[model samples]
Target: MRITTETVAAAMKSALPNKTKYHFDDDLAGFGFYRTTTGTGTFFAEFRTVAGGSKKRLKLGRVGTLKANEAREAARKAIANAALGKDLAKSRAEGRAAATVARLLELYNERTRDKRKASTADGYDLIAKVNIVPHIGATKAAAVTRQEVQRMHGKVGKARGHYAANRAVAVLKAAYAWGGKHGHVPEGFNPASGVDRYREEPRERFLTDAEMIAIGDAMTEAETIGLAVDAGTAKHAPVGQRVVMSPYATAAVRLIMLTGARLREILHLRWDEVDLERGILRLPDSKTGKKLVYLPTAAIDIIKGLTPIGAFVIAGESAGTKREKPRADLKKPWAAILKRAGVSGIRIHDLRHTFASIGVGDQMGLPVIGALLGHSNAATTKRYAHAADEVQRRAVEAIGGKIAAALGGVK
Candidate 1:
């Protein structure tokens, strides 16, 4: 029977239960309405591709939403397009294949898992979770415009500061590049490219001699009185209870100051990495790759005094019946030490700067200091050139005074 307003209305009202009924239009082939047992009806278009592909069914809309005349017109156009070599089914599939930003990030993470270090991978993942995913994760990779990325960069910079904003942009750039390379995004499309990165000055925070002494004294006092209770099982101490620092935490802090190593480099140091016979640390992997850290006698003494608890030098509290893993972080103990020393507005990394400052004051050249600090680039060592200039000034003054004295103090 022909599908018209009368027939469609009749079908909707009298369609049998637990059965589906199809009413084909005598006027147009493959244009029809199928009524389900529950009296719900939908108009659909069915056609084969010009290349003689299998028949495909495209749902136009529900009976109430689309009249029979509108459905027939849509079906006519669909059939015409199919005959003109357009594959509607394939087009729909390609639309689904356009990956979202979240999907691209996942692919990027998987691609770099083996190549990137655990810390580096964690940093990238954090940028995605904290910055990118929260804002534009659902947007299609190809649909993310450069203007959107620039706006996000600006917003993050205003809210969090330039450094964090630059980092977020860098992570997005890398992810988009990876997505493009892997065909997850459109070829030659990168929304993060060509955006200007904010200018960032190198930050150096060096500790003064008195500050170092105060910190040392505080750390000593902390170790002497601090408890090493198992955090997993121990009850919370009273509000006013005097808490002590962990021996491992104290040693780690001191080692960072003495050795000029990064916090992670010290915390992640293993027993196998220490060379007591040569008084050096042979790190197989570091930020600057393989490095040999020469230990001063004081630093060696600290290392010698530490009792190994697990694989790491700074081992965490043991889990029930299982060996403990490396300590995850030193936030609490570092805070306590800083508070006791009455020091504020300093980071653990500043201890490294302090070590460099001392070397500079001792008249060591920048090249030598750079080598000791495992700096891969001379440009990085150039930050200490001003300290060397101070030494040069003192040397020139002393020589000029001696010359004047030799000339019978003429001036």
Candidate 2:
């Protein structure tokens, strides 16, 4: 029956549990409602086709949010739009193409990674695939729920259990929700909702005095091997081979050790951001999004040998695009150096660990060390606690005994 005023009242009261009311008869073109977990609304279209008798049905709205007459009119409009050779569904796709879970990943790469930081964009890809697309990327956007979000959170929690893993999942949740919000998918999705946002427990990993010395020795040996091999490799180049390692990388590493700056801060450095005479390396912005850095003498000499031909401090690395160029990873040479120097289980980031460890070892004040590390929160700086302060005293007279002995039996 067509949804006339009388028919709508009857259909609204009708409990049609298991059948689809296919076509409209007479003035009743198309009309029916099926009870569902998602509330109720459907409209019928009685249309004639060349392939004999034909019928179609379309959803009206969630039962309570829309009135019966309102639904009837909306369905009529949808039918009219459909008749015009335009897809109402396709019109609302908002230009985002997510074919399979894999395709969503590809589109996400084009939209995010191509223009953003490599490290940042890689993170979006990793979690979106590992957590989301596998579970529900195929599910139509309208079908998501709070329970599914909880499952995703649990999955990330199970897989990594680290602060980073949970954090990655949160970012992925944000991205999916963002997709929905922008009409890439339907809105009102609770992708990041209903899951407990757990706090990361305290983690401290600064190396000890012995460990620091061992790693430094390893780094030195690695530099030796790198220098020995770099020349032979560079000579065979046909024409213009991009220089992989900067002359200042070693000294810069030393400066990272001495000053406790983040790896990216120095790695992304530019000549425009430096000041030789003022002995200051002024940053326009940092990971914190504020531009601030004070470079002491150690940072200057390390880069003094550098000719900043490109946009970065290690002098020649690329920035601003993901695929600009490839640079050498510190892995092999570092491993060779570490093996020769007899160090074990240390990463390049551990250099920062060593830096923090030294400050804690030197009897320096905790707040002072925190400032040197550029930490806004003392709690973050506190990771160096017990480890940062066990090494030295303020006055040189405290170590005069060693100096006296070095004076060749003058003592």
Candidate 3:
């Protein structure tokens, strides 16, 4: 008899006690269903691994869970795989025995700890926790599909933003690549390999001269008379209350603006790396590896004025203790200063961009700007090309205005 929906329903209804009956599609030899005496039924595909090999059964699903056409399609694929010497049942069983994606990620993290920077490893762990592991970590590493990774990417993009979603997929791709290299997964089987990533636009924010003056003024006020806190920001404080900022944090910001150094480079700066006499920072390591940061007089003055609290130039509360550490971040002080200065939509990193813009405005040349910013790649500093063009345009405009004025003082 043919194993269609109606026949399966009839078989389930007429099933006898303490007995089992098997029915199959006459047109498709391997596609069939088995009904138990208790009235339960399951659909399955029974096929030989090869032309004359022993038979294997791959369960499609229960009758109600999977419809007739769906089961038939599944059976066809199973049979096709069997003809190719692939046993679907054995592969599924082996997948069940393989390490889960979470386990693979754990191993990947542990094995690559020494190879990755501490901050980089921490970032991977964060991405896994916040995005990846929560979604597909339980699936067997070998069985993870591209569709699953794509879904995760789409979901993250919808909830978070494209930037965050892209970061999540990037970490997943790296994890899978690492897993493949280390034999934790099949060498050529990376689920995230072909998944399309979200497009990301580079952020461009430069501080204008007026804005810079405002920020500097705000920093000075924050250190002395204190900046007023926004109403309702603090739980206990009344509206328009004032709070003094940390001297070290203010100095750190000034140094960033003056020297164009990255937040971490300045925050984690140690006394040994500084040379007051030479006006240079002998950084042993930065994002671009070992580098020399020539300091301006203003930058040197800011550093010299800071009272050393610990090994770190910018000291946190835990400075000078057994757990001596640099300042964790300058979020609070930076925010207050921006609010006081009426500046919005600016990040601390933007200060670095502002520095590059200033250098371009001065026609310092891209090479000099790149060297000062410790950019190992010329492409990175090339982002400031627009600023250089703007400066040149203004200069040409000035020359044209002079010629025009000399030609006509009548108008």
Candidate 4:
């Protein structure tokens, strides 16, 4: 039932030895409550902030910890904080110490934008919007604790997929680190730290040379690669399977395949940042927010092939409409390519994994491969640096010495 302070007063008046239900309606800010959802003294307070806004709930305290007067006082304080511009939702989030999650996200995005690429900004938005905001967005940045982070890690990292959870944590940690350095959040080691606890399991996704050849050939022949629908044909996929692939798609996919530049980088490419004649594509700001990527010959060829007669290399295939251009999924083309190549369960991103593997197979150094991939750190590159089991075993069982010894007698 709906709760308010008057109902809470009535429940407290009828209280017995067990935890009792209470409600409070403060400031027409809507109604909230104090009750036990599962019984046995575990109290929860649920409420709505505005007359028609969403209903939000928070855990108040245990039976002994919260008396009616105590709950009433707490509610009063919350209302006061809200009136004074603090949010209880934020309170339930990070605890009671630092900045709120919302503020941190805002700061990070604002500071990183034109300073970085549109794609980079978009990526941060996705991760924050999906993982952080829904769970702990309201939490105060300073109030977030190690235990809270651990619980979160368990949930988001889920049972077997820890990579995404780890990434989300990394983003938070980086934010905190930045916060401390710049006086955004208090100075302290990241709450998400401690490798032994939140450590991630290994994930492998790389293609062999044979697999690469097959997939590449398949992609070249696939009928329906994704592209932004030009204006005249917004509702339907283009009549012709191939529309010369927009300058963006052509250069972007080629670049993505060759150098594995994030899709955002390709979407936001500007002519001024490239020097086709000099074979250099300059990134004004990287994810690290420092160091421009210097594209070598092959990457240059991909960019060279992408010359939009106007701004944005892809020139956006909106067909001259106000609506934003649609991203090319490559799903159909990817599926066809995979089927033709007899491969399954691989993603376009794996093509990036392919780039790293091919580099490793060619005996190129790890650091060189990373630099080519535009990774700012060795750690990021190492994810793709791991060779397949067969490949690794091939190195150990070369039989170079033994073959030479058997031939040595002949020699």
TM-score of each: 0.69, 0.55, 0.68, 0.49
Off by over 4 Å in 1: 1-98, 138-151, 154-160, 194-196, 226-238, 317-325, 409-411
Off by over 4 Å in 2: 1-87, 90-98, 102-168, 186-201, 225-249, 307-309, 315-336, 360-363, 387-411
Off by over 4 Å in 3: 1-103, 116-119, 129-148, 154-160, 228-241, 403-411
Best-fitting candidate, scored by TM-score: 1
Tens digit of per-residue lDDT, candidate 3, span 1-411: 877878877777773747777788899988999887777777889999977778788777778867888889999999998998888888765654488988877887788888877657866787788888888989988888999999999998998789878888888788788765544665557888888998788999989889999999999999998877776467566767877788998999999988899998898899999999999998887777888888999989988898887799898999889989878689888988888898998999999999999999998999999999999999999999999999999999989888989999733
**Candidate 2 residue-wise lDDT, 198-249, digit = tens:** 6786544556667667756655554443333333344644333433333456
The alpha-carbon lDDT assigned to residue 101 of candidate 2 equals 37
lDDT of 4 at 50: 59
Q: Which ten residues in a row have the lowest lDDT in candidate 3?
A: 179-188
- Give me candidate 3's TM-score against the actual structure: 0.68
The TM-score obtained by model 4 is: 0.49
lDDT of 1: 0.82
Model 4, which residues run further than 4 Å from truth?
1-122, 136-155, 158-161, 169-198, 202-204, 223-251, 260-264, 288-310, 315-350, 365-371, 374-411
Q: Answer with 1 or 3, whichever has the higher lDDT.
A: 3
